[model samples]
Target: MTGERSVPKPLVLQDEDARGSRLKNTDLSDSFLRNLKMRDVEIRDVDLSSSEVEGANMSDVRFHNVRMENARFDNVNLTNVSITNANLAGMTIDGVLVTDLLARIDPDDDI
Candidate 1:
């Protein structure tokens, strides 16, 4: 038998403040972490795939080489966000396709 186990769900937190906390190498996959003030927290090497985040405020967050495929985002604000070296294929903003917009500037796209 394989030693594979399912990820456990997270505890529901309501009106809790966890700011100025340092978390390193934490595994929070398949967890339900929703609605609990988490501002200015330093998170490194954490897995947050398949996580549901709604009605939250996030500012000054930096991500590197994170996997976010098949993720749905609704009513979220991203001010001054920077995304680099990531796939933007089939992504649309205001009915404008990202791939289509890049195609216009790079016709041949040999660079």
Candidate 2:
């Protein structure tokens, strides 16, 4: 088999406080972001394919024009988040029960 692997892109964090910061227009392809606490963070026009986000707590997060293909979100707590025009294909949220956290996203999604 050919060695064709997709590497995850790096996450550009705003600052130490991560207040009013946003990770927009980033290219995080196939990267795994785990155990990170994100608050009031906005992700727009980013590609997060095959990324594993586990044990992370997020609040007031906004996703606009983001690409989330084959992303894994397990054991993650997303309370009061928002996502718009995001491509969420093959995303799995097993073993995690979400509430208002994912309400910002869509409920009638096929992913």
Candidate maximizing TM-score:
1
Which ten residues in a row are the worst by lDDT in model 1? 27-36
TM-score of each model, paired residue for residue: 0.58, 0.34
Model 2: per-residue lDDT, tens digit, 41-88? 444444445444544544444454444444555455566455555544
Candidate 2 at 106: error in angstroms? 22
Model 2 CA lDDT for position 14:
42
lDDT of 1: 0.68
lDDT score for residue 13 of model 1: 53
Model 1, residue pairs in steric clash: none
Worst 10 residues of 2 by lDDT: 91-100
In model 1, the Cα lDDT at residue 70 comes to 69
* TM-score of model 2 (CA atoms): 0.34
